[model samples]
Target: MYRYDNYDQTLVDERVTQFRDQMTRYLDGRLGEEEFRPLRLQNGLYIQKYAPMLRIAIPYGMLSSDQLRRLASIARRYDRGYGHFSTRQNLQLNWPAIETVPDILGELAEVQMHAIQTSGNCIRNTTSDQFAGIAADEVEDPRPWCELIRQWSTLHPEFAFLPRKFKIAVTGASSDRAAIQVHDIGLRLWRDDEGEVRVRVLAGGGLGRTPMIGDVVRDDLPWKHLLTYLEACVRVYNQFGRRDNKFKARIKILVKALGIEEFRRRVDAEWEHLKDGPQTLTPAAVEAAKTHFPEPERRPVSDEAIAAYEQQRQEDRALARFVTNNVTDHKVAGYKAVTLSLKRRELAPGDVTSDQMEAVADLAERFSFGEVRVTHEQNLVLSDVPVDQMVALWQALDELGMANPTVGTLNDIICCPGGDFCGLANAVSIPIAQALQERFEDLDFLYDLGPLDLNISGCMNACGHHHVGHIGILGVDKKGEEYYQVSLGGNSTDDASLGKILGPSFYREDVPDVIDKVLKVYVESRHADERFLDTYRRIGIKPFKERVYA
Candidate 1:
């Protein structure tokens, strides 16, 4: 976790004071709604369906236990006694009073957190893989690079008001857990033959009214010029990206119109002057960023401990399933990354109660070095749990209703707040997610299906990232009637691909049946040991579409 310094602390404290004054003016009628719109948006406040929603950024999805406790306290005092974790790894308080938002921000500031850059058409939070440094397959930690970009993009005068919101993701792992390919700017970090760090830059990828997998604009960019090259790309977009239409204003639209080659050429020309400038990263700066993320202390586990874990697994089926689905292999031996499921039945997909949040904070302190991580799929991660304590952690999580054994399964759905909270949504997404979860509550059946990503979005804004799910459900409004559209074969991985629509949209009540039909087709057609995604990729979408529409 990155700690705040004097400069960082002062910056946030000052912003809170500034926003408080601005809000007072708005409430006092000195400022109209139209006049206060941008100011409030930049502070991460949105006027939703019923009340004001406040989105707080969890940078790169990292949080300390103390910070979690503060968030829980804020939720208890300000809003309803719960918070919804978003698909971008941010948290949203849906019922915050407009007048008291400043107080909420002040509380967040005490924990070195704030809502700045969480909204508005500026560079949003830079995200990375939740597994980051501990993932067994990671080449290097991408958090430092994410942090560097965060500092550079925050309140940058040059990019303060882009045509549309910009999102950037970095991944150093062979697996693309960060969904880099679908971001406005995606950086893949790797070492060259001489062992020097480099980046593969992808541009123009997004999912809204139009969905696209980013094109590779720069195949091999030296790590030293990371900031310079990024600046060049943004500069090109800012200058040429559409300003006439909000729907067409994103960088993805610009990349499509100009083509990848021309986009690259323009960026390269801009980079000529910026390369090796003072903004270019030096060894000392990179080292300083790395120091912010020191590795957690570890102790060696004896062979007897491993044997005991294996013995416990054989005796307890639920524990075995929890380990199989919720636990991931860590880079360090005798340790695992455990994902806490927030998608319990009867609740919204990403909603966490205040008590649950406090419980997780305590568990993180006791089991995982007082740190927690939020994943893009709307789950939390205790990234450094020792294998020896796995059983106890599992029991604690189960007691808190966080151990669902459904990570990467059909029941672990990614969903947006939809019409329930967001005014932009045409249909409700949470109920659909809950219906599907209830329909697929059988653990044995889910395990048999194997590693399915079912994502739902209230509308085409794609906040749920439905475009990249194995099975995507998008809410559509046909003459004010709510309908759900289904897509298949989408994925967010090393070989990222956008999902294809199966057919026309279905009625709201019909969506669960439609999903069941799609899964049935997959289970019948799949070869031995094939996942839903693998089966879909192998057999194409025709089989599932035929069954779904039949």
Candidate 2:
């Protein structure tokens, strides 16, 4: 985690004071709703359905144990006893009073966190793979680059307010854990055959109403020019992106309208002016950006440690299941990445109670090296868990109610807080998610079904990333009635694809049964060892749609 320097501390402190004053005026009738709207949005406060929702930034999803403890403290004192981890790798409090948001911001600043640019039409948090620094297959770490973007874009005069909210993601491994292809700007770090680092830049990719897989604008970009090239890309969008209609303001729409070739040409032209300018990332600057990250010390371990872990796995079936589902291989010889399942029957998809938060912090300190990661899939991670301590960590997490071995299963739903909390939502998402969890209680059945992605969003904003789920459910409103729309064969990997909608929307009550029928077709029609997505893509949507609508 990057420690805040003097400049960073000063900037956040000043912003906190400014926002407190702004909030005081607004509450005192000095600032109108229209006048205060942008101010509040810039600070990541939204007047949601039930109360004010304050989104706190967790840059690149990295958090220290101290930060987690602070968050837990705030959650216990301010609003509810829990907070929701969102898809942007941010934590959101759903029930804060409007007047207290400034105080919340102040608390967050004490931990070197803030909510600036987390909302409104500006570049939001720069996200990356949760296992960025520790993934076994990684070629380079993307955190430094993410931090550079954070430093450059925060309060940037040029892009303070774009045509619409923009998102950027980066990944450094062979497998795309960051879901980079669906972001407005996706950067892939790769080392070519010659051993020189190269960046594959993709532009115009986004979900929401107009979902798109980004096009590759530059395939052989050097890492030194990353920021400059990004500037050029955003500069073009800023100049030509649609502002008249909110629906068509995203860069994806602009790229579609202009075509990939023309968009590339414009970006290239813009790059001519900014490519070698002051924004070019120097080697020292790049190294400086990376310096703040803590690297776990590698130590040699005897075969007894390995033997102990294997013996534990053999002894406990539950431990074996948890390892199979939630544990990931690490780059180091004696370490593993463990994901804490937040999708349980008792809670909303990403909601973690303050008690759970503190427990997770404790586990991070005991098992990992005092660092935790917020994943895009709405889970928490201990990235550097020693292999020998896996069983102890699992036991603690199980007691904390976060050791459900549901990772990569249909029951591990990625859902947004829909109509229950969000004003923009057309219908409720938690109930639908809860229905599925109840309907699929058998863990063996889900594991047999294999790596199925089921995501739901309250609206077309795609906050839950429904567009890329293997089975995507979207809420719709027809004459004030809540109806659910289904899509199939969606994927959010290196080979990304937007789901195609099945015929008509069904009533909320019909969703579970419809999905059951769809899964029945998949189970019957799939080849041996064929995943749900593979079967869906192979058979196409006709069978699923026919079964779902029947």
Candidate 3:
């Protein structure tokens, strides 16, 4: 994990002091709600249904055990006894007293974490794969670049007030676990034929009133010119992105209105002045930043983990199922990535109790070198667990009520804290997730179904990333009644595309049946071994639409 430098420390301290003064003025009636709105939003505070919610940034999803413990402590002392991990890989405290928010920010500052840039219409958190350092397929670790972007974007005067919120994601791995394609700016890190690092830049991707896969603007941009190209992107969006309508203010609308070629031309023209400038990335600075993220110390043990691996393959097939489903590939031999299921079917999908958080901290300390990651899918990951301890770890997690063996399955749902907690939500999203989980409980059947992502958002903000799920569900209000809409065939991989709306939205009672009908069509029509997404792509949405509506 990257620790804060002196500059980081100073910035956070100053920010807290500034916000403290701003908040005091608001309470003293000098600043009205309208006047104070943008200030509070920039600080990551939102006035929700019952109380104010504060979002704290977890850069690139990485956290040290000390940081996680501090978060747990903050939750216990200042707000409720738990925190909601968001799809942006950030944490939100739902019931923090508006007056004490500055105090919360101070505590976060002590741990080198803060709520800055977690919200508002500027550049938000720059996210990456949770398994960045440990992923087997990674060309290079993406965290250093993510950290660099974090520093550059923090309170950037030029981008502080964009037309709309901007999100950027990076992925070093061939697999697009970071959901890069759906971000405002997506950078895929790779090396070209001569072994020089380069980036594939995608622009104007987002989900809301309009959902889009970012168009590739720059292919194989050399690493040294990263900052220059990024600046061009920000300049372009700032100048021409929609400002008249909140719904169409995102960069996606701009890209769609101007064709991808024209958008690229505009950015390239802007890049002319930026190239070879002082802001361009240099070898020394890149290498210097890379030093902060040295690889974890390794000991070459006789791959003892393979024995446990074989035992798992032979013993309880359920445990094997759990292992393959929840664990990701690691860069080092004798080690594997483990995902602790915050999506425990017995509870709300992403809610973790204080005790559960503590247990996770303990596990991270014992097995994962004192580090944990929060994924965009709303799950927690111990990214480098030794493979030999797989069974024991599974048992421990199972005992702690954290193991559910449902990663990437139907039961592993992504749901917003809907009407129950969020003031903006029209209906409850958690109950809908729970109902679907119970309805799709058979693991063997689920395994047969293979690799389905079901995401739900209460309304149109798409915080739950409902736009890119393999099965996307959006809740809407119709005539004082709650209804759920389903969209199938959306993808978040390198070949990203938003799902088309299947039909009219369904009443809450009709949701599960509609899903069942869609799945049945898939089950009957799929070619052997084709996943839901593959099947959907093979046979377009028409058949499923007919079956679902018929």
Candidate 4:
């Protein structure tokens, strides 16, 4: 993880002091709610349905054990005892008092963390693959690039007040685990034939009231010009993106209105003067960034240990299922990336208690390398767990209720805090997610269904990224009554696609049954060895829609 230097520390401390003053003024009636709105939003504080919600950024989803402990402390002291990990890979404190947010930010600053840029119409957190450095399929580690972007975008005067929020994701792996296609800017890192690093930049990808898969605006861009090129793209959007309507203010809308070719042309024209400017990256700078993320030391595991793991898998069904679902192959032979699922039966998706956070911190120190990663799927990853210690880690996680063997299953849902916490939500999303989890509690049945993504959002904001789920559920309001809309065939991958609506919205009580019918149709219609996504694509949405609406 990147440690903050004096400059970084001073910046965060100054911002905390500034916000503290702003908050005091607001409370003292020197500033009104309207005046304080932007000030509080810039600090990642939101006035929610019942209380204030504070979103703390976990840059590139990286967290040290110390940071995790600090977060746990903040959750316990400032708000309720639990916090929600969001789709953006940030943590949200749902019950923080408005007056106490500055104190919370002060604590976060002590741990080199902050709530800066986690919300409002500015460049938000820069995210990347959870297994960025450890993934077997990675061509390069995207964290350095993510870090550079984070530094560049944080409080950038040019982009501080964009028409709408901007999100950027980077992926070094061939697999699009970071959902690059659905970000305002998606950087895909790859090497040229001559081994020079390059980026393929995608623009306009976003999910909201209008969902879109980004278009490649620039391909094979030299790594040195990454920042300058990004600046050009954002500049184009800032100048032309609509401000009259919040719905159409996003860069995605601008890209759509102008067409990819024209958008590219405009960005290219903008980049002409800025290509090799002060912000352009250099080899020395890249190397300096890389120094902060040195590779972890590799430890050899004997063949006997591997044999024991295989033997355990053969003997214990539960262990086998856990390995199959929660564990991923690491680039290193002896290590594995283990996902600590936050989704349990009764809890909302991505909700982790303070005690659980502390437990994970301890487990990270004991099993992994004192590091944890928050995934876009609302799970945590211990990216360097040794294979020899897998069984012990599994037991520890199980005891902590974090070892759910439902990763990539329907039960591993990605959901937003919905009407329960978010004032913008039209209906409650957590109950729907819980109901679906209960309806699909059978492990055998879930495994049979195979690799399904079920995501829910309380509204069209797509905070839950429901647009990209295999089964997307969006809460809707019809004549003051809450209803749910269902969509199928959506996926966030190399072949990203927005789901199509099945039909009119269904009542809240009908959602679980509707999903069951859809799955039944899929199971009956799928060919041998076909995954849920493949089956849906092969047969089209008609079969599922017919059964769901029947």
Off by over 4 Å in 1: none
lDDT of 1 at 227: 97
Model 1 compared with the native: what TM-score? 0.99
lDDT of 3 at 77: 88
Please tell me which model should have the higher TM-score, number 2 or number 3: 2
Judged by whole-model lDDT over C-alpha atoms, candidate 3 comes out at: 0.88
Candidate 3 per-residue lDDT over residues 1-550, each given as its tens digit = 7887898899999999999999999999999999999999999999999999999999899988889899999899888798889888999999999999999999999989999988899999999998898888889789999988888888999999999999999999888889888899999999988888999999988887778888899998999898889999989999999899989999989998998999999999999999999888888889888998888886554655577676766788878888879987777888889998887656677788777888899999888889999988888999877777778889999988777888889888988998878998978899899889878898888988999999999988887788888999999999889998898888888778788789899988888899899889999999999999999998999999999888
Compose the digit string of candidate 2's lDDT tens values, residues 29-141: 99999999999999999999989999999999999999999999999999888999999999999988888888888999999999999999999999999999999999999
TM-score of 3: 0.97
Overall local distance difference test of candidate 1: 0.93
How many backbone clashes does every candidate have? Answer: 0, 0, 0, 0
Give candidate 4 regions above 4 Å deviation.
Answer: none
Residues forming the 10-long window of minimal summed lDDT in candidate 4: 541-550
In model 2, which runs have C-alpha deviations exceeding 4 angstroms?
Answer: none
lDDT of 1 by residue, 1-550 (tens): 8999999999999999999999999999999988899899989999999999999999999999999999999999998899999878899999999999999999999999999989998999998999999999998799999999999988898987899999999999988999889999999999889988999999999899999999999989999899999999999999999999999999999999999989999999999989999899999999999999999888887789978988998899999999999999999888899999998876898899999999999999999999999999999999999889999999999999999999999999999999998999989999999999889899899999999999999999999989999999999999999999999988988888899999999999999999989889988999999998889889998888778777
TM-score for each model? 0.99, 0.99, 0.97, 0.99
Alpha-carbon lDDT of model 2: 0.93
